[model samples]
Target: MGRWVLHLPVALPRRVDAVVLVVALRDSLGHVPALDFGEATVSAEDDQSRRTRVWCDARLGGGQRCELPLAHDGGCR
Candidate 1:
């Protein structure tokens, strides 16, 4: 298994907008690999330190749905 990082940038709340997360993967051939998108959760804390945590429990394979958290580092409850 390889390591991948997902980055999200959004304006501080109290502003009306939508967060967009694009999930993509590349193969060994340096091409967009067929992703087997599975069930996952992205969470952030409600307290001061908005540390985001992501949890993935499903088998992945080419493309997947983006599950964004409502807060940062609240421990994926």
Candidate 2:
């Protein structure tokens, strides 16, 4: 197995109730029928700098994770 770290910076207009990181297999039909791996309630932090940090971890090729700042509208602004 290979080790890797993925970081994704997501900026949203509003904060969501929950953020999930998912890993799945996509077929030729472009359909993700199921999630090969899933993680929830990652890491969300507010630096008081108008930004929230959300992040998670998985195996190689699993997916990307990030930390985001909190916004006023429930979503990342």
Candidate 3:
């Protein structure tokens, strides 16, 4: 399939709330092979193009990537 973005609007007024929702959604949908949780991000409603990644997403090796939080300390998973 080609690349595409799915925008799900959250009416919550806080960034933390929105981030939590997205993380929850990712966990629930983790079973889908087509979904790349590492690529997950959140952006302000006024600027959807400017994204803040939720995960470190650093390339580890052999088609694998770091699954830790973006600002996580210690080694990447």
Candidate 4:
């Protein structure tokens, strides 16, 4: 298995609430596998240094229009 990185933008209203990362993978057959943000150092900065890292299991899909859902853990299961 390989690893994939996903960066998401923090919403304004949700900034007050903690947000976890969600990584979704889709292929020609549609959504197959995905992962949630377990370990991260999320920050609310616009600079490159302030970025959250979301790890996902590769070999899922690298095709076009791959749906990626980003949300808090237990929020999207």
Pairs that collide in candidate 4 are none
| Among all candidates shown, the one with the greatest TM-score | 3
lDDT of 1 at 40: 21
> Model 3: runs farther than 4 Å from truth?
none
- CA displacement after TM-score superposition, residue 27 of candidate 3 (Å): 1.5
Candidate 4 global TM-score:
0.29
Model 2 spans > 4 angstroms off: 17-37, 40-77
Top-down TM-score ranking: 3, 4, 2, 1
The better candidate by TM-score, 3 or 4, is 3
- In model 4, how large is the Cα lDDT of residue 12? 40
Q: Give the number of colliding residue pairs in candidate 2.
A: 15
Which residue segments of model 4 deviate by more than 4 Å?
Answer: 13-15, 20-33, 47-77
TM-score of each: 0.21, 0.25, 0.80, 0.29
List the candidate 1 regions with Cα displacement exceeding 4 Å. Answer: 12-16, 19-77
Q: In lDDT terms, which candidate is top?
A: 3
**Per-residue lDDT of model 1, residues 1-77, tens digit only:** 99665444444442222222323221222243433323222333244254323323222335333343344343332
Candidate 3 on 35-59: residue-level lDDT in tens? 8888887788898899889889899
How big is the positional error of residue 31 in model 4, measured in Å on the Cα after superposition? 12
Q: Sort the predicted structures by lDDT, highest score first.
A: 3, 4, 1, 2
**Clash numbers, per candidate:** 13, 15, 0, 0
